[model samples]
Target: MRIGCRQKMKSIIKSFNQQGFAILHGVLASACIEAVKRECEKLVDELATKLLALGRISDTYDDEPFEMRLIRLYENHPSETPTIFRRELHLRGFFELFAHPRLLTIAQAILGPEIRLYPNYSVRPKLPENRRTEVLWHQDAGYTSAEADILRMVNVWLPLVPVNVENGCMEFVPGSHRGGVVPHEKDEYYLRIHDDHIQPVVAQAVTIEINPGDVVIFSNLLFHRGLPNRSDHVRWSVDFRYQDATQPTLRNTQGHLLCSKKHPSNVVRDAVHWAELEFQ
Candidate 1:
């Protein structure tokens, strides 16, 4: 059953507050979508060119038989990695997508009035012919050690292209939040530390197909992952996590400073880890 606008917004807010996830369908209008798509294409082309010039395009460690759109230029060329955002290319314009007013407003509403922006922001592009491994299901918390209760972190996933179930869109287990942090399977991303079920209930599955510019909001504790991209076109998206001012943070999380108009201010404390870190 379709719902009225006011009711829909209320439900969305409520759902996110309770379950730590919410999908705002068609959040980005067509024009903004086009703008982001074009910018992403241009950035991808630029990054790819640089990598090729540097002779760094071998095969990604996680590289399987899948078609790869973006090859983690920074991951391969860590020496050239930018210092601005989390493992990002130091591309300011591209990182701006995280702080887009509409995206932040929704995050602010859920994370509380004051939030601190993590310096870590990134873009994931699943290119045509890039079909290797499935983005194993996991929670954002699996990558961090922040306080679970006081933390008000929200990850905003903005798709640069239309996302559908067939082409490896994200799938969420509705009400999975009630289960708390389930143990995850340790693979390439991060190993499951706690003893939780590997397979979550499929009956509650809800695949979200978002158009360009649409944003999906979810917490770090939610169980989610990107499906395999089977489409001929590339699937591109960016992510940003925000924490409430009262929560703890990783000082060197991604090894970047946490200050940008595009970043949030709601944070708790900041810490650092010397061990190698992957995406958060």
Candidate 2:
């Protein structure tokens, strides 16, 4: 079974290299997923409480289901609601997911033993028909400044609920990363690849339909976009990058080291420690 598992990961790594992305089905434990969900619920509770005090929300929507609560909360006042979570993610559950050994192994295969959890980690709740949540077609590299070529990164994404064309699932152009970073023009909400650069291969894009506990890893340069969420519930997902620790993050904040042979002491110690540390 160990050999079989290793072989499967080998295949996934190969696919990731050639196709610019690879999906690993059922790679996460149900307990791990539940932990993150609990954390998200806690965050929502906190947000609801604050909003109630500030007169931003008439109702907390606490009785709503996890997938529906946030969407319902913001339905009346979308502008006041937050769509993305960053620093607030330093919870025990999120730490367990981010520092998971299996994920770190995959990161190590691609980025060597030294790895850092990149500073761009985010948890997004895509509300139904919200323009603020619809991501445009662009390479992850395109978002970075001059470091687009230097930052070695692989992005990992998974959905809390099953995702498809209806709920803002992502689509990727196969082998698009090979072309490197393409020119991206500024859109109102996000940067989009210039039409001249993406039109030819855009038709060949594959929709990434995935379920909870399924993880998809893609290159930083992969051409990708998220469809609008037409479903009634919020489509929640977390994305984080693992970087080769040897290179400079090129930002003011240095991300936490997840693994390292030389700087073993600097590695994030445990879930409790992760929760204690603030986003840097």
Candidate 3:
């Protein structure tokens, strides 16, 4: 690796080790960002067409900006708006961002050379005035089985649009990962940390405001939540995880191998190959 690139990677790893999270600014190329935006636009357009055909919406809202289009379509029918897109993630744009070499290198810094993209990848659209989009405070590990505690993993969150407190930016409790798994309860839409544990650290919470090309890498054990979208537009972001290849995912679905020094043949070759894999 080049000297400058190596230095940046080292800094990211150091920050992650100390704070349980790190932010890399402007890491993604403009072309990659535009591609993902285009894909999001296509998805919204398809949904609008379907809603119109069903007489749920009178217009497709085709001319609206990407941030406002989704919000307008689900104005009357909030339940119809998708909070997460799990299937069809093998699309070209998603695959490009998923397997971007720079991102994989950062993952490699923390997870060694062998890395596997975890199966729980998602693209979230946090819409305005939508209760479904308000995520509660909890650790990512809380949602997984107990066996997952042993899995060495890191999560990467990249926003498609600018995210701030009003648009439901994520908030994190610094160094909270040092505390193992806390008790969580099933809430209406998400699992939340118990009040006793969350209250003490709530004051330390930091709202993560980020731009389109910035990426936030945080520990799975970190306490975090997505605030409500009070702004008029949608907050679009993609989140995915990378785990050490040698560890078990604790789930039936084995995620795709992203990189491996010992067995390079296992790594995903290109976007076309990614499109062939089934969503797990």
Q: Best lDDT goes to which candidate?
A: 2
Candidate 2 lDDT at 167 equals: 94
Candidate 3 lDDT tens digits, 3-76: 98789888999889888999999999989989888888888888998999999999998999989898789889
Off by over 4 Å in 1: 1-8, 51-86, 89-92, 128-133, 146-150, 189-200, 254-280
Error of 3 at 94 (Å): 1.3
Ranking by TM-score: 2, 3, 1
Global lDDT of each candidate: 0.58, 0.91, 0.89
The root-mean-square deviation over C-alpha atoms between each candidate and the true structure, in angstroms, is 8.2, 1.2, 1.3
- 1-280 per-residue lDDT for model 2 (tens digits): 3998889879989998999999989989999999999999999999899888989788998899999998777777887667899999999999888998888899899889999999989888898888989999999889887557778887999999999999999999999999878899999999999999899999999999999999999999999999999998899998999999999887888989999999999999999999989899
What would the per-residue lDDT of candidate 1 be over residues 1-280, giving only the tens digit for each residue? 2367557767878988676678777776666555555555555566667767777775332332112345354454444432112343343344345445656566666765555566556666654334333566677776655445345577777776678876778887766655555555567544543434535465566788887756788877777778877776556666677766455575554333233344434221222221122333
Please estimate how well model 1 matches the true structure, expressed as its whole-model Cα lDDT.
0.58
The segments of candidate 2 whose C-alpha lies over 4 angstroms from its true place after superposition are none
Report the lDDT of model 3 for residue 251.
85
- Per-residue error for 269 in candidate 1, Å, reads 22
What lDDT score goes with residue 24 in model 3?
Answer: 92
